[model samples]
Target: MTLAASRQSIPDDIWAKMQGRSWHSDRGCLPRKNLVFVTLPYLNFSGATVEGHLIVHLDVADDVMIIFTEIHQSGKFRIEKMSLVDDYDGDDDKSMFDNNTSAYNCRLTRGGATMSSHGRGIAIDINPVQNPWVKGSETAPANGVNYNTPDKRDAAFRRGAHGIVMPDDVVVASFARKGWKWGGVFTTRKDYQHFSEDGM
Candidate 1:
């Protein structure tokens, strides 16, 4: 489907989860689809605020509705329980910090060397265990660079494909249609389940 159609086709449930959240255009960019990239306000483990962005593939109106639903259901629904990782300090080197140290436990990484698109608050990393970074060495790389665990090697593949896992494809597609890029497609390695606002 065309990007525009995809954006318009966001699930009602997801759309209702986004409402009243302030949007900063300077921090983000709009893509070909009806997607609007916006910065997200997040709190770090140290109680510091980190700003990031995600290229929301769904229509703003629909997402607003979804946000409302998420808020209304809050503790009652599993889908409504969105958790942010504590390691991201929202700094420009979040990727470096997250990858090099266990501080962030390799939960998330900054997109690039400078202020990453994530720093704008429009991107996200769902669950790390289910989407562990693929690295070249025996241990996870310190730079947050990752490759997808081979489906055969990854025990979560079955659960991931069956929807019992994180990094849902629909969610990824929703974001991608808006020109957001998934880290799964990284050249050196494949993240298979990572998504981002960088259209690259």
Candidate 2:
């Protein structure tokens, strides 16, 4: 069923918590008028399901999950770990990446000069440990160096180490089905952890 068709609304407190970021400003980011929340099922890497929310622009609410049907049909809907952006406490990208946390932080682009799709709730960063950002010789979490390769591994480095998410991985495929762009395809820097509405 569609978000509007279901007539569901995210709870007040949960919605508040999701937007509790210090970078929420009246800048170029999408205004509150264009944002909405929808619940999405989060699956751990092990295939267990958990409750999660997907913040998105109001215009795309109905179409956002078109890919979910294909994923479910293919038995690939398992999210492999999902959480709200408010779960993390700081703006430190490296720290959050190290912990393999997924959130919707409202911060500027990596350079902090302009608003990021994340700041507008149009983008999401998944398992950072498995999908760490890469620029030149630097990786978001130093430990994620091993995942920089195009090889996607289902299991983490050690027992709990983050797994590798490759371009053709189920996660990327699901997001792609929804018309979102993966940063791993970037030519210069690879933000393997990111997916955005417009590939921003």
TM per prediction: 0.41, 0.75
lDDT (0-100) at residue 89 of candidate 1? 34
Which lDDT tens digits does candidate 1 get at residues 100-141?
Answer: 111111112434445333333344443333344564553233
Identify the runs in model 2 with alpha carbons over 4 angstroms from their true place: 1-10, 18-29, 77-80, 90-95, 98-103, 151-163
Q: C-alpha displacement of 200 in model 1, angstroms?
A: 5.4
lDDT of 2 by residue, 1-200 (tens): 32222214555775566454523545554665566665554445676544555656676665555543344345443445455555554354644454443434567788658767776666767667667788988887766677766543334433344345565767678787778898888888998777888898
Top-scoring candidate (lDDT): 2
Q: Which residue segments of model 1 deviate by more than 4 Å?
A: 1-81, 85-112, 138-148, 153-155, 159-168
What value of lDDT does candidate 1 attain over all alpha carbons?
Answer: 0.35
Local error of candidate 1 at residue 191 (angstroms): 3.1
Give the lDDT of residue 124 in candidate 2: 69
